[model samples]
Target: MRDRPQSDTRERIITAADRLFREIGYQKTTVADIARTLGMSPANVYRFFSSKKAINEAVTARCTAEIRMRLEAVAASGRPAAERMRALLLTAHQSVLELGVTDAKMQEMIAVAMAESWGVIRAHIEEVDAIITRVLRDGVASGEFVPSDPEVTGPCIRAAMMRFCHPGLLTQCHDIPRPTVEQQADFILSALGHHARS
Candidate 1:
């Protein structure tokens, strides 16, 4: 019963941190800011999270979970491989753009994660890759996609999508619209020399 308040406090801290990270970015936000947002003291915030980096990691994990959920939903839909792949790319593209453009805090948090929280970023990438690999394998087994090594194909597809989805890359290449999932799917199919639609 005593643990209940501690659990609530932890959750409140995490929630406040997530919202601030999405709004003001990780680099710009301080522990005091989060504590103020939660109507608590900076010392109280420290009791839950020792450092700003720790809070960033928690926020990143939450965001990555959301991304995985969205991807899983798309994968679970009874769509063809080509359509599913396209949907995945579009969804990822939109997510990145939304994070970078509309959610400045999230973009800053991502930058920090890439620079300081590499382990967290790497783990998230691996999880996302595993999901994509499973989806590709399922598509092949169901005869919706051609035989291809998901181990190789999954990482390659992810890398390509990451390049297009990267905020810095997109900013530099603003004149060019990011490729649709259909275009990326076609490229992958051509590389595999198999009809993803069939």
Candidate 2:
């Protein structure tokens, strides 16, 4: 019989690693732990991943991929661009919120991912920015937004919504109740030169 596919083994490693990260967190979880979960030796795990950090990066990528899929559907929807944009921003905030930032174990995992797996996180940010840019361009084309440079405007929207999107900020700012994600989305929509229906 043919040996197991390398990609299958790699995905198994990532799936096991993600479950472990959620259970024990990034700092406490180790290669040995992941290997044992897979009923393999640590040396076997090493054959697929160079280090725990690499495994963590894969796990981070998987989590962010969840958000990306939702954002993509929002961006591609047939609704007016401004409305889609509002939905997109709120969707992003909700997606990150669903990642269990309140759980101490998941919180520690997020903190470590932000600190150690920054490149993976940064790529996720860049992809999100691209999605925002797409909506900006769509709004401009439809006269729903003022003509502006999307490259600059995209990141600005991301920065403006950082409180909702960032893991720590969601927890830290939860007590301050003035501006909900809906309010922020409206503010962003207005800033895009959109006038909501009366």
**Candidate 2 — which residues are off by over 4 angstroms?**
1-4
- TM-score on alpha carbons, each prediction: 0.83, 0.93
Best candidate, lDDT: 2
Residue 40 of model 1 has an lDDT of 90
Candidate 2, poorest ten consecutive residues by summed lDDT = 189-198
lDDT of 2 by residue, 34-63 (tens): 999999999999998999988888888988
Residue pairs in candidate 1 whose N, alpha carbon or C atoms collide under 3 angstroms: 25-105
Model 2 TM-score (2 dp): 0.93
Model 2 lDDT, residue 89, Cα: 95
Give the Cα-based TM-score of candidate 1 against the true structure: 0.83
Give the per-residue Cα lDDT of candidate 2 at 29: 88
Model 1 CA RMSD to the hidden true structure, in angstroms: 3.0
Cα lDDT of candidate 1 equals 0.75
